[model samples]
Target: MALLITKRCINCDMCEPECPNQAISMGDEIYQIDADRCTECVGHYDTPTCQQVCPIDNTIIIDPQHIEAREALWEKFVVMHHPV
Candidate 1:
């Protein structure tokens, strides 16, 4: 599933650079996660780098509206990183 940055984000700016897909960006008030570009770092790493680096707990959560299976995420990763 794609991840969403909640209001709990402290705007620390730590998670943005950790995203291998460059899915995280500055929002109006805080950081936001781009579901289209987000694959939870599946192809890049075992765990989500943004989540791992975010200091605020619960700031990053799965986007229920954009829920996806593991395989779907992996497919997205491959398509994004290895487009033909």
Candidate 2:
């Protein structure tokens, strides 16, 4: 599933640079994750790099509205990083 950065984000600038998919960016108030580009780091790391790097607990959580299976996430990764 894609991840969501909650309002609890402190804008520490930890997650934005860690996302391999470049899905994380500065939003109006905090960092935001683009569901269309997010793959939970499926093809890049065992766990999402943004989640791992985020110091605030539970600041980054799965998007209930954009849930996706591992295979789907992988496909997104492939298409994003290895487009033909």
Candidate 3:
């Protein structure tokens, strides 16, 4: 699933750089994750890099509305980084 940065984010600037897909960015008030570019680190790591490094608890959580299967996440990863 794509990740969502909650309002609890402290803007520590940790999650943005850790995102393998470049999915995290500064929003109007907090960090935001781009659903289209997020692959949950499927092609790059065993876990989501942003979530792993996030200092604030519950700051990064799965977007329930944008949930995806492992296969779908893998496909997204390939299409994003290995586009034709």
Choose 1 or 3, whichever is better by lDDT: 1
TM per prediction: 0.97, 0.98, 0.96
lDDT of 2 by residue, 9-37 (tens): 99999999899889999999999999999
TM-score of 2: 0.98
Kindly list the per-residue Cα lDDT of model 1 for residues 1-21, writing each as its tens digit: 999999998899899988999
Q: Is candidate 2 or candidate 3 better by TM-score?
A: 2
Top candidate, metric lDDT: 2
- Expressed as tens digits, the lDDT of each residue in 1-74 for candidate 3 is 89999999999999899888999989999989999999999999999999889998888999998999999999
Reference-based lDDT, residue 72, model 1 = 97
The top-ranked prediction according to TM-score is: 2
Off by over 4 Å in 3: none
Question: What's the distance in Å from true for residue 31, model 3?
Answer: 0.5
Q: Return whichever of 1 and 2 wins on TM-score.
A: 2
In TM-score terms, candidate 3 sits at 0.96
